[model samples]
Target: MARSLDLACRCAQLADELKAKDIIVLDLTRVTPEFDYFIIATGNSRRQLHAIAEEADTLMEKSGSARIGIEGYDSNAWILQDYGDVVLHAFDPASREMYDLERLWADATRVDWQAYLAEHA
Candidate 1:
């Protein structure tokens, strides 16, 4: 559990490093059985979104998390990288607002990922 949380928070940090905005880390432990955490971020453009996704893929790999799959890369609106326990959603600003994942997954716990990084790092 701690390992997964660390991976999730590190992925969120990756998005932040790439200048992704409105980054969120949602703990889905009790909310869903499908995954453990959802790391979502809003990118201003397609390039930025791709950068976040790409970096996340690399980070997850180094964390010993094999990516299960990916989606919406060509769409240039949202890119999803699914690890078994952690999933990342990199979205364009408009796409993020349209999806409103925060509201959609309101039941999940919103993790203060930045604080986690500061304290843990």
Candidate 2:
């Protein structure tokens, strides 16, 4: 697999480690050239969201995917981390429902990250 896709699935796996809810990775390769995947997860609370983001950032960087930037850390609604090819979004329930990214990017293929994680493990 491409490194980008691996990172994306790893992000999903990490999110699952932190007990994130409704985790999904959207394969955006066909949707746009801007990025390869989007790992979207809903945290139970702000602290959980922060933990998920921080851990993901550390893990990605340690794996050589330096973070380009992070946004919405101050907010309890959503936190977005950009690692060039892969972007992970940690959102609270309300914000996730409000944004409805899956519906917005309906064309993007939904990845079976859990299966990938199991195989990798």
Candidate number with greatest lDDT: 2
C-alpha-based local distance difference test score of model 1:
0.91
lDDT (Cα, tens digit) per residue for candidate 2, span 59-118: 998999899999999998999999999999999999999999999999999999888768
TM-score of each: 0.96, 0.96
> Highest TM-score, which number?
1
User: What is the overall TM-score of model 1 with all chains considered together?
Assistant: 0.96
Cα lDDT over the full model 2: 0.93
Residue 11 displacement in candidate 1 (angstroms): 0.7
Off by over 4 Å in 1: none
CA deviation > 4 Å runs, candidate 2: none
**Each candidate's lDDT (Cα)?**
0.91, 0.93
